[model samples]
Every structure is written in structure tokens, then in C-alpha cells.
Target: MSDPTPVFDDLRDESDELDRLVAELSPGQWALPTPAPNWTVAHQIAHLAWTDHSALLAVTDADAFRGLVEKALAAAETFVDEGAETGARLPSAELLARWRQGRAELDRALRASRPGARFPWYGPPMSAASMATGRIMETWAHGQDVADTLGVVRAPTDRLKHVVRIGVRARDFAFGAHGLPAPAEEFRVEILGPSGDTWTYGPEDAPQRVTGPALDFCLLVTQRAHRADLAVRAEGPDADRWLDIAQAFAGPPGGGRSPKGDAE
Candidate 1:
């Protein structure tokens, strides 16, 4: 029918999931080491919370927000220069509370926004809906990192389709940004989410098929795990190549190495 509305529904859906996950965890589990090296679960969640706050600033003041990102990146680079693992440690309870507050503030900001309100982000300007969807993808990516670390699992949800769709669209952007040929053919991407939800992207009759568990797809796209580390399969070369460097989220190319079995 009409173009799919990417708005309040996706935003609310993703926001509810994130808040639910954080609220459900045991305090001790919050500090568990996630897939991100030297970053515990708390760190990952804290980053989400912090990003929401940053997004709000961008919505309110574009220049100030850009300055915020630059300043934060500069400090982060300094820490990375000193030691790859360097980070500010936080007390457990406080970190969790901070995450809760930041997310709450973000939700409030989104709910209050007027239609056509624009916000600057890591990529092109975003509307309130786009802002929320981006946050949803971020939560799932990091949630996988957390779930992977604990040996626990997150069931797939239909909402994953949004993340997959975004990732698929970004595939071409990733290639073009790197001075590579834009894939002219379509690909079929199917993720069997933990909840038994299968999301399909690309042209229906395309030659390629990228199929796997939702968690695995998210991990591969996020660069948190090598393709080999997950149960992933690609039927064609272009599909394989796209899977190799899928930067679904915005910002610079992550430049992380692809895993062994994937993109080989």
C-alpha cells in the first residue's frame, strides 16, 4: 500500500524494549563484561543512556550538539591513545540509575516533539521518528553484546525487521562511502528472530539470500562478532560482500575486521 510509516510506532516499540531489558536485569548482572572489549554491561548501557542525552541536545541546539560530539570524541581518542581499555569506572547502582534517567529523558523529548521537528545525529539530519528508530537499533546491537557476554539469549522480535531494513539500506552507503561499486542487484535478507519472527529485505526475486538468526545478523552488522562466530549464510557474492561490511547505524565506517567465515 502506502510507504511504511516509520514513526511513533517504531519509536515506542524500541523504547519499550530497551526500558524493559534494563529494568529486568539483576544488579550484579549489570556489570558483566559484554562483547565490547573491557566494556562491562554497565558501560554498554551507560553509553546508550548517554547517547540519548546527546541526541536531545542535538534536537535542541545543532551547533552545540556537534561540539558535544567533537569534544567527547577528542577525549575518547585521548583515552584510547593512552590505553585501548581506558574508561571511566562507575558505581553499579549509580550507573544503572543514570541509564534509567537518560532513557526517560529521551523518551520524554521524543514524545513532546512536533511533527517535522529535526535533530542532528551521527549521520544525516533525523526527524523524531528516525531518532527513536536509531536508538532502537543501538539498543538491540548492544543488547546482543550483553546477552553474548552472559551466555544468556535474547529472543527475536518483529521489531528486528526495522534494524535489518536499516542495515540493508546502509549496505550501499557503506560501499559508496568506501569508493566501491554500488550493488545494482537486490538481495534477500532473512533473520529468524528468537521470537520466530523472520524479516526479509531487498527485492523478492534477487539472486542472493542472507539468512540467519536475528541475534547473529545484528552481531555481524554491528561488528561485535565475526560472521563465522554466528550462524550466517549467503547464497551470492554480492550478498556476502554486503554482509561483510554492513554499517546499519550512522557515522564513520567502523573499520572493524570481519570474522573468518564471513566475507572470506
Candidate 2:
């Protein structure tokens, strides 16, 4: 995996960016719809904060581990199963504040933990480093949705590797999530990042170059943007379709891609 320190840094930077944006929003702005259907800007922040809270609780207190994991899963389930009514009715500000605190705790836990410390995540045991990286990616990717809704663009940061890693590793997952078979052959992923970090996955020369600004690539692959809307490109039919169904985040498939532009 990429150096763990930078991963945390990217996550931290992204988290900070989102915090800054949300902290300054007027009360009315908090209720605006993001690219995510039915979710308001406040809901997006709440989800990120809640996710971070789960991460921190899992790492810092072992006795609460199993229960925390279950709670996290249940929260995702509730979010997915609930409709607009749920979002509209939920306390948006409280959700955001809860998550904000959760993230603060997670940042502390990550700093104190060892690199390979194990944690219970979505599947298979993963290292603390991986979990931290996932948090960074998720936080930033969601932050992008909020930023898009506000029409405020955040400059691509070097710390995007966190999400880029998930985007590459989760490529094969697109097929199954879409009810299609996993590819018979492996696909390589190449990311041209903002800070000149070149990330490659699969074989050295496997047939795919996700050439474009790293931010756009990450945003698109994370299902935050439509492939056609961004400068991102995918070679071969399989690669292209993967972009159509690509989802770096966990939980049920987010409603199909937005039509792009104002449709966002």
C-alpha cells in the first residue's frame, strides 16, 4: 500500500476542508440538496461524521467493538432503506454535530494506533492503516458532493490517494454490485494525481489508463460524477461500463448516475 502517513494526511486535509465549509454555512444553506438525491448538505456531513465516529469507537474501545460495528451497519441500512421522509424528518444539525465530534475522536485514535492494528470493517479483517485510508477517501468523496452542490470547487490535493486506492481496488466490485459477473481478466488502473503521485493497479501494462486530473478520476470512480461529465476516460468496453456502475463507497448501490450538469 502507499505510505500510510500521506494517507492520513490526505484524509485529514479533506476532513478539514469539509469542516471549514460546513461550519460556515448559513442555516438555510444547510438544507440544500446535494448531488446525492434526497440528502441535504447537512445529511452528507452527518453521514461523514457518523462514519468517523464509528471508526474512532471501533479503534479506541475494544469492548464496544462488535456493537459499534453492528451499529455502523445498521445506520447504513437505515440510511439506505429510509426515503426522503426520513431525511427530511431527521435532525440535520444534530447529525452534523455528532459526526463532527466523531471525526475528532477518529483523528485521535488514528494517531495513537499502530499501522497494522486490526479493525472490524465491512469485510475481512483490515489493518488500521486501511481503515484510516478508507475514512479519508469516504470523507473527501462525500465532501466533493457537498462542494458540488454549493458550486464551490476545492483544489485537488495530494491527499486524494486515500480515495484513489479504493477506486482502483474496488473496480472488480462494480460488476457484482451491478449483478454482472466479475471480469475474467484483471484490469490495470493508472491515476495521474495532482501532486505528481502516479498510482497504478493490476499488472504493469494491463489495458486501462484512467488518464485525467486525479480529482476528476477519483470523483467519477467514487460514483460522485458521471464518466461523461468529467474528463476521465476508460479504455475497452468493460472498463467503460465499470465507470457506469463504479462505486467506491460501500452499502447498497446509490441510485443510478445523475444525468450530469444541472442534473447534478
Candidate 3:
């Protein structure tokens, strides 16, 4: 089995990168609206904090985590926004502090878990590595929203590997979420990473294929950018459809972003 320490280290770096973006923001800046409809910069951080808190509970207290799951199941649609809304209402400093503390606690809990132990999540059980990957994907995606709102262009890093991996792995979940059966045959996916190295998945000779820049694929799976605005291409019918519904994060299909240059 692969060591999960590197992934956990990457998770911390990803979180810190995002922290740098908002650490110095003024209260008014915290109120600045992000690309996610009705979500401000504060809302983005609040959501991450909320999720980290949930993750902490999942790792350290199963019963409490189950309670959270029940709460979410009861209000599948509103619970996410409700959590963000509640946290977003806190004063900026308090919110920032809470987010930092929660994620720190979560990191420690994940590192301290027994080997091979798995924890429940919204979609399925996950090992510590899988949990870290999911958190990094979300951090990057929401960070994109905050960056776009601030007109900042974040430099892409190899940390995107985690996001790309989750995106590729979630292909079947993406289809299933939309009530479609997953294609039986695997589709090849090749993406050019930020460093110009190609990241490839599935059989090379597979009839279906997707090829694109890694950044585009990550943005696509996260639904942070509209498909029309991305460079990802699909060579077969199933692969083509996969791009349309691809989502890295768990939950119902999201109402994706409007195309670039289109009115919101």
C-alpha cells in the first residue's frame, strides 16, 4: 500500500496556499462575491471550515459523524448552503480562526488514525489518503472561485494531481449521479500537467478517449468553469457525455458556471 503521508503533506500545502489568499483580506473584501452564485469569499472559506469540521468528526467520532450525515440526508439540498451561511455570518477573524483550528484538528486526526482504517463520507467510506485528496480538490475548486472574484490568477502546481486523480476516479460516480449507467469499457484520459508532463489513465488503446490540459480537466470536473470554455476534448460518445456531467466532488450534479463572456 502507498504511504498516505505525502498526500497529507500535499493537503496541508494546498490549504496553506488558499489561506495566503484570504489571510489578509479586509471585512469588505470578505463580503466580495465569488463565482459561485450567492457565495461570497467568506462563504467559500466558511464552507471549507464546515467541511473540515465534518471531516474531523468523521475521523474522531463516528456517532457524531453519523448525526451529521442524518442532518444532511434530511435536508439534502439546503444543508450545504445552510452550513456555509451559518459560518459565513461569523465575524471575519472568528471565521478565519475557526477554519484554521478545524482543519488543523482534522489533519492531526487523519495522521493519527490506525493503518487501513476507513471513515464514512457523504458518498462512501474513505481512507485518510482519499479524505485528503477530496479536501484538496475542494480547496482548489473553491480557491478558484475566490481567485476569480479577486481577479487573481493563481499559479498552477503539481498539487493538482490529487484533483485530477479524484476527477478521473469519479467518472463513474458522475454518470451514476445523473441516473446513467457507467460505460463498461474504460476510457483513456490524457492530460498535460502544469509542468508539461502528460498524465495518462486507462488503457492506451481504449476506443474512448479524453485529452486536455490538466488545469482544464480539473476545472471541468470541479464544475468551476463551463465546459464550453475549456479545452478538454472527448473522442467517443461516452467520453463526450462524461465531460458534460463530470464532477469530482460528491453530491447531486451542480448547476455549473456560465460560459466565459456570457452574462450571469
Best by TM-score: 3
- Order of candidates by lDDT, top first? 3, 2, 1
TM-score of each prediction: 0.78, 0.85, 0.98
Would you list the C-alpha lDDT of every candidate in the order shown? 0.70, 0.72, 0.94
Candidate 2 global lDDT = 0.72
Candidates sorted by TM-score, descending order? 3, 2, 1
Q: Per-residue lDDT tens digits of candidate 3, residues 102-145?
A: 99999999899998999999878999999998999999999999
Q: Give the TM-score of candidate 1.
A: 0.78
Clashes of each: 2, 1, 0
* lDDT score, candidate 3: 0.94
On lDDT, who's better, 1 or 3?
3
Clashing pairs in 3: none
